[model samples]
Target: MDLSFDCIVAGSGHAGSCAALSAIDAGCKRVLVIEKGPPEWVGGNGYFTAGAHRTVHGGLQDLLPIVRNATAEVASTTDMDPYSAEEFTADIMRLGNNQSDPTIVRAVVDGSRDAIGWLAERVHIPFIFSFHRQAYLVNGRHKFWGGMVLSVEDGGKGLIAAHQQALEKAGVTVWYDTPAVELKLDHGHISGVVVIRNGERLQLSAPAVVLACGGFESSVDLRAKYLGSDWERAKVRGTPYNTGDGLSLAHSIGGQLAGDFAHCHSTCWDANAPADRGDRVLSNQFTKSGYPLGLMLNTQGRRFVDEGQDFRNYTYAKFGREILRQPGGYAFQVWDARASGWLRMEEYGDDVVDKVSAASVTELAEKLQAKGLEDADAFIETVAAYNRTVTAFDEEHPSVKWDPAVKDGLSTQSTRESLKLPKSNWALPLDKPPFLAVKVACGITFTFGGLAIDPDTAAVISEKTGQAIPGLFCAGELVGGVFYGNYPGGSGLTAGAVFGRKAGRGAARVMRS
Candidate 1:
């Protein structure tokens, strides 16, 4: 096999795919992609994602041309509000607690719209309106609640297939089960990568190396060391291959680390999910993000978080951390017939979770007790208190209407007769018969900390000199400082494409210069 290449990309996931394709577009004839897993485990975490891509668009009209599901009839029924650049940036800054790296965030925001267009036109990703996940049919219209909208037709699997088609058409080569073990440096510049190819340690020559390998969320030891004491036990929501190989390779060559090492983009996952890996058939269906329309009770049988604090898109990522903090590292989401019908079937379907249901709230608590709930009486009392509070609030504001498509001020927060905890939006009494409940646990998506890089060029920065490391580029979950505490939903995929494209162009520039 030829060991020489103009550019080498580590990991064949979404970010690496974009990097490789961008390099080819930038006139690089010899571009290689290396994967740590076998051909069956091809796309890494990108294969397990929802394939949601958050970007700026001029509402339904601007996105109509790109999305396959947006027919004329569908467009008439869809009421999607335009998402602006400012709104997108504000979301990240706000959710991340204003700690996102400004330069990196700005570049991703500025490049987001174009990246979406490229994914549709160049990569041929079958984009569709995220109707099931982000929209609710209200008043005979599909009203999109959050700023996020588009997703791949069949989610991440489809996204990977699309990238593979693009890569094959571009004549790019991908090597499976060939993990990049180390980086070779020559005169303070990146030379190539050392890889365990065919059980032999081989050194491949390249002027530019793009590291899109992902985070340390897979390594139990690394998870405990970086994310905290409890993170080692957090359920792995994606690929087991993201064991921080690229992080180690970059660290060996003085790559600086930035972002939150103690935090990650986690979510409320299925309590029965496997501890260390994701189910290939289930994928992101394990996510239980329907808490906004209901209440979550810990073992103590009391509401822990404001379930309706914000749109699920803004709050779902960090809520997993809260779940891990609860007693026995678990919680139960309770909903009645009034709100249970709103939960997405993909996530809460009978086939997806062990659904526990009862004809009344008291019986629901008893059924939940058999499924590991601690205080059945407390669960019942919690329901009674919540219903009473909602009833009182309704009496005060009789004209208020409960709408799921927006933060319609229907809430449990009141100066009088309110519980200690509040449901900030979409609050309705759990008096409707046939209550339902599901056990949930923390699912770690990706670690937030990673290599520091130049926002403009996607070039890795050195810890030694605090300057850009020549021929070294980073993107995807392995590129940090774009997020801190929490992240806006769908921003991760968008940032990957933006920085991946930038890294690809930057890689080609290294050869020319």
Candidate 2:
């Protein structure tokens, strides 16, 4: 059967929901949103995100000034204090290494504030300001909620429910468990989407189609192809349904991909560990123990990348690149009691500390003996040195330059003060008994690369000539390079609102014309 809609949005994640709602609100007579999985399962990398929503204008206008102001405010709240738009742009450019699309970057940054504000106005959704609350502390109950659409339940369920309510209110039709199998193109323009529902193919025509179906974190072949062998071989900890459906369909329609080489949250929890109980962990846990968070070391026990370096300055991809140079493509985080104590302080609510302490460092080494670094003594020495260096650093550099956007600085400072440690102690020495060590392997949550799009209109762009792909739009993970290298505080959800609205409104306009 032939069906038509003013706009068609694939995926019901944050981005898809926002886009559909925006389009219908913009006066589209008919809008249809298709999800490959059930709404309850409409989760990808976004579910695991820290929920940072950075905007400049505070939901005033879709422009760059608002983004700069919002960034400044977020920085101020985090104690970094008063960053400029130019600085924010510089950070983005430096982070992305100048490979991002300038136009898209400008649009995303400029429109951030308004997008966040728009989401905050929703009656059912509650938006929390992350920076206003001080940095994330180890055991402190810190929940990040800025410009995010959260439900009353305070989990993925809440976010999905909020979006569903908004979409329904705006007169948008949602098709759950309906996977878009193909894109229909006519005369070099996207005309419709072919969806698979209950084993039957249904062709739904639209004037324009928006692909917000997220990335391929769960797809091994796509991960291997776009990311690296490590990602290809590693286990996934993000959404299961994010099988690169949008990428495949877009590629079939001649859409070009960008940032295919990027992925985020390089370190993940060891699902294989019996104690882990199939939960994910980050490599930064090593840093919590006063060891190098993402430093590089060889099988023979050596230092790489100044183990004391900050995680914000580098991406997980960089860490993965470093770890791959070591023997067996794996590394260990070594630390004694003092280091474990500090880690325990920081990881207050998290279960990492408990798991690390359940067994001795020697026993832990034996557990990961097959992974490499079988010498427990060498690991112990490494922990000792790490503790000494951390203690020394605390004495020398009393002031910690904690970036609030990523973590809770106030809690960190409070923890340090309570311990009677010097203010500059960036490193907490690991000195206590029963030293702990754990083998860490890289894991990816989502691919950073996908169809290139115009930030202003959320329209896909061709890589060959840098022109907008007519009648096609995209948002969320499908839009590459929007986050540059380091993801800003809340850009994921903000992008869903900003670009989702733009794509929806743009598609509706096209339908009317």
Candidate 3:
């Protein structure tokens, strides 16, 4: 086989796959994909997601084909609000504290819907509404809020499989278990890539190379160096192979480092979850969100953060860092039967290692005490105080238009509840029987720090020269300046697809030139 190619893509995640597919579609004579991970775990961080993608759509009418089981009955009862490109961009920028690169943010927002539609139409990837995560039942109707409503049928794992099939159908060759060791730059121009496969080192020449090998989230040393000292102990939420290879590779050639190094995408995961990569079978099952419906207590049994500050999609990523700040680097999500019903089904699954249930608050406190809770009595008192200060639940009131999807926060009886830290939304008194608690720890998803790229062409930009490095492109989490302090769920995948496709086309054009 010829070892030379027009374009080479590193990594086999959603970004790399899309890069390869677009290159092949763009009429590249030979496009090669180098994946360091084993074939079974080739999708990088995207393999563990629920496959949610934030995109602009014209309400239910525009989503009917993409969302599975979109019958008239379901459409009438479900509120799939229109999401505009402006709204999507605003959400990302607002959540990132307006620090995100506007050009990249605009690119992501503009291409998001088109990317999803392309996957549905060209790649034959089936999508469905993430009813469980983005929907709430209000007055016998299911209302969907947030810009993220569409998801792949079988989550991230399935999305990877679909991409693999699409790549195969497109005649793209993927070299699995092959890690790119070095980039061969000739006269500061595009040249070739050095890779090792099965203990054999080989150099393959390519006019252009696209780096989509993900972030340094899985590297303990890198985490401590960039994310903070406490991040070394945080659980990795995705593939362990995603060290700093992509960042290092790009940096070695004068690529600019950008974005918030101290911040990352994180969540509250099970305390006993593997310190390395999460379980593929359970996937994101260990994540324990929905704290707005209940309360999160530290080892000392105190509410440190406002549980109902905002929707879980907006707050889940940053809250994991808060859990790490606790005494034991963990916390517990406590809920009663009433609130339990509103919790995501995964919280009640068997994969949760530290789940405990009790018929009464005292009994629940005893169970928590057994698990090393510092003060069981204080926990009970905290719950009592919360209950006394909470607004009365009256969803059936004739004068009330209580819709969680549209409501600002959880309703209070008269908006005059007195408390130190109040539950801003979805506050219900924990007066029901069969109380439950799940012990949780911090799970770091992906690092926000990465290589800077040209916003329009997805070309890697050199900090030293302040110009694009010829024949080098980038996409996925490895491309920085997109996220900062926080992230809106489902935007990562969209950005990956958007930028990945652009990188492929750009690389192909470079090769042709």
Best by lDDT: 1
Better of 1 and 3 by lDDT: 1
True-structure lDDT of candidate 3: 0.86
Q: Per-residue alpha-carbon lDDT of model 1 for 1-513, expressed as tens digits?
A: 789999999999999999999999998999999999999888889999999999998888899899898778888898989999999999999988899898899999999999999999999999999998999998899999789999998899999999999999999999999999989999989999999988899999999999999999999999999877888789999999999898899999999998888899999999999999898899999999999999999987888999999999999999999999998899999898989989999999999998898999888887888878889889889888988888889999989999998998888867678988888788999889888899999999999999999999999999999999999999999998998889989999999999999999999999888
lDDT of each: 0.93, 0.58, 0.86
- How would you encode candidate 3's per-residue C-alpha lDDT over 121-190 as one tens digit per residue? 8777778888888899888888887678988877888798899899888888899899998988999987
Which scores greater on lDDT, model 2 or model 3?
Answer: 3
Misplaced by over 4 Å in model 1 are none
Question: In candidate 2, where is summed lDDT lowest over 10 consecutive residues?
Answer: 275-284
* Tens-digit lDDT string for candidate 2 (1-513): 438888899888788887887787778878888877676565445554444455553222233222223454343333223334554455566666787667767777777656655765652454443322223433343322222212223334455666777777877787888989888888877789888888888888887998998888777777667666655555454556788898888777677887635555344234232221113233222222223322233455554544444333333334544554456555666555544443333232245543343245456555545556556566555544554555544455556443323431211123223222212223444445565655554555556777877777888886566888788999887888665444443445666767888898888777877
TM-score-based ranking: 1, 3, 2
lDDT, ranked from best to worst: 1, 3, 2
> CA RMSD for every model?
0.9, 7.3, 2.1
Question: Quick one: best TM-score, which candidate?
Answer: 1
Clashes of each: 0, 32, 2
Candidate 1: C-alpha RMSD after superposition: 0.9
Instruction: Please say which candidate is ahead in TM-score: 2 or 3.
Output: 3
